[model samples]
Target: MDHNDLSARELAARIRRGELRASTVIRDTLDRIARVNPQINAIVQDCGADAMAEAEALDRRIADGQQVGVLAGVPVTTKVVSDQKGYATTNGTRLFQDVIAPQDNPFLRHMRQKDAIVVGRTNTPAFSYRWFTTNAMHGETKNPHNPALTAGGSSGGAAAAAATGLGHIAHGTDIAGSIRYPAYACGIHGLRPTSGRVPQFNHSGPDRGIGPQIMAVSGPLARRVDDLRLGLEAMAGYAPDDPWTAPVPLIGPTFRRRVALVKRPGGIDTDPRILDDLDRAAALFRAAGWEVEEPTELPDLREAVQLQIDLWLSDGHEAKLAQAEQEGDAGAIALLRHYADRAAAIDVARFGEIFARRSALIRAWRGFLEDYPVVLMPVSGELPFQQDEDLRGGDVLTRLWEVQLPQIAIPLLALPGLSVASGVVDGIPSGVQLVAPPWREDICLEAGELLERGFGFPALLPR
Candidate 1:
């Protein structure tokens, strides 16, 4: 039936109306994964047998006229970093390769509660640190569109799975630009909801540190913004284990359909092609009755990036460096070396100052959002890099890190950022990032839909 080509929402609706059986859909999904996963290395842990059993059970429930979940019959892939029950939460590192999970984190728990079948677990870089996905344990996840380009990291596998139709919607976590960049690289959509918008906790590991508490969040990746919205609704809810979680409403106060456009964050220019997409995106907004404004000045993203680094490294980098050494993962070691000097100087006092300064930064962005509900910007200053671009250390790696300030800065402000895939530019996938005030993901998704109107979702790979 070519069910893989439909959106998660559409598939779920079909399941609800008895037009499709959950077991048949999941079996087809597993078959597709078997055929395509080897080429991309996206799904590292196949949960095919378990997913099929669950699907069969769901089919029975539906036959009995039982009410199903919002994501019924939808096949999705979970990021390996999260503790999916009974699976190894490897985080793409050898250190935790044998540590089995005891229970599902908020993500998979919610996904299961909503009857979404997880066909496999996706890969990530060691420590979920690199912008490119690879590890000694699971190997590298390549872009489904172009193997030469990277599958954006941390959540790269999730994006690739969605881009290739291996999964209709994918579970993705974003602390920096993990979800957004991967979505851009693979020609899909991902949302980095405001911190705590989606509850998270790892029973397989220790409690989350302060920095992650303030910045890290789990969100969704999909080909359709509508599916992304459905993913969010199903995954968001209070989980007792996470102290940071709350019963925040999915929809927020309405605002003017206005957008603040940023071509260059911190005065750094983007690729010419990205600039053109930004132009086309703005025109689409205007045509859709949105007022687009190029603000004379915007929040200081460079400073935000600086503070984000300090807070992120507050737990000290030496321990991580030692772990990276033990894992013998080149990319992880390279990342640690690149930030050694900066992370070395951060301590208790610096962390204190970060929070004090963070308040003002958040206030500034909140004020700006009050004026303009959404910000239209590039997901990355550069296009998807050649695969393993970070492997070439020294100046090349440093430049790669600096170029992603647009992505690095958002997590610091605790705002919702949406990555909307525009189209393929000269064979590489290109996209824009939409930022909304904290807890206002609705605004970002609404803005993304408008930009998507101009350059519809890219066709799935392997055509």
Candidate 2:
């Protein structure tokens, strides 16, 4: 059987039924990665030996009448920035390449506890600060569908891996659009759960500063939405190490089936093709017996986006800029400089301003969600841009972030957002973004399933 073609759900079910040995599935997954990874540069660090050993161990355990995990025999890749025991949490830079992790982070620990084999570690941008993925360490990851366009940054490798069947599910992190944009760029689905949904901690480094503590989170990327659900359930287990997360259940109570559809988020000059994608998604919801409406305006997304950029500067950009300069990666330097300029200044009062505004914005957005439980919008203002588009600087960088407004704004609200592939558009892959109330990832997934069926995207896109 082509194990690479099976969704995590289907593969795990088959394995749990003793239809396939864990070792066989893992060997096939490694073979798939060896054949496809070079073209996309997705999985930066291969764990083939470790994977085989674990797979064999799992097989032995099953034969000995051990309990089966929900993700038995499933293959997944964690982002390089995340801790996976004995691997370097490179985070796309060589500065800390020697800083090997002694223990797995909360998410990785949880995945292993559920018998999900880690086949490799995916790439990320140098500082994981940009929407385009490229770095001096792991090199650039290309879009598997069209190398000319971006594979999506930070979590680009994760998305590319999912798109090309390198792994059944790809683990990703989202502070901005790291998870969603890559999924959109590579024609896959990525879920950015609520801030506290999945435990977040990296013992290999100092604890996260203010900005990341609040917005940054771990999530799942997969070719199938059901695989995403499996990945999430495996990852969302409680880790006492991370104070942000709790013992929350994956399923949440149902809310009204009403959705608000916005053509342009944060007043972006959305492309006509993107507008068409939104219409297509809306039609799917309507077909699913859900109410879809186009509101005159929602909360001030533009302002929230600005605040997100500001939050990134909580520690100030000087040190970050210096690090990027040291790394000397063109893309990292360019992005760090680009956004740092926007957030540069001297102000102790900025912290006060940030929180007060954050509170007010949260209230506004949460109240808005009270009326519309879900919001369907474009993943970006335009289709995935040409690879290294942001490196062009000036108008290109400006335009890139303008369309990324939806992605950059969502994190500030601390809600669950899902990116569901809408199939390739005009030779470039594009998709729709779904937002639900905090801790209500189930709602987004429910709606994503309807959109997924309507779009008819296969579990894996053609590479």
The top-ranked prediction according to lDDT is 1
lDDT of 2: 0.87
Q: What is the lDDT of candidate 1?
A: 0.89
In candidate 1, the residue pairs with backbone N, CA or C atoms under 3 Å apart (3 or more residues apart, or in different chains) clash, namely none
Task: Tell me the number of clashing residue pairs for each predicted model.
Answer: 0, 0
| Backbone clashes (count) for model 1 | 0
Give lDDT tens digits, candidate 2, residues 171-288: 9999998999999989899999999889979889998878899999999999888888889999996789898887778887869999999988877888887888899999888888
Name the lDDT value of residue 217 in candidate 2. Answer: 92
Looking at candidate 2, the ten consecutive residues that score lowest on lDDT are: 339-348
TM-score of each: 0.98, 0.97
Tens-digit lDDT track for model 1 on 1-463?
6886787888999998899999999988898898989999999998999999999999999999999999998998899999999999999988998989999998779988999999999999999998899889999899988889999988999999998889888999888899999999999999999887898999999987788888989999998898899999989988898888888999998789988999998887699989998999999999888999999989789989888877775466888889899999998898888788888788778778889999999999999999999899988899999988888868898788778988999999999999999898677999889999988999888888777777886687875
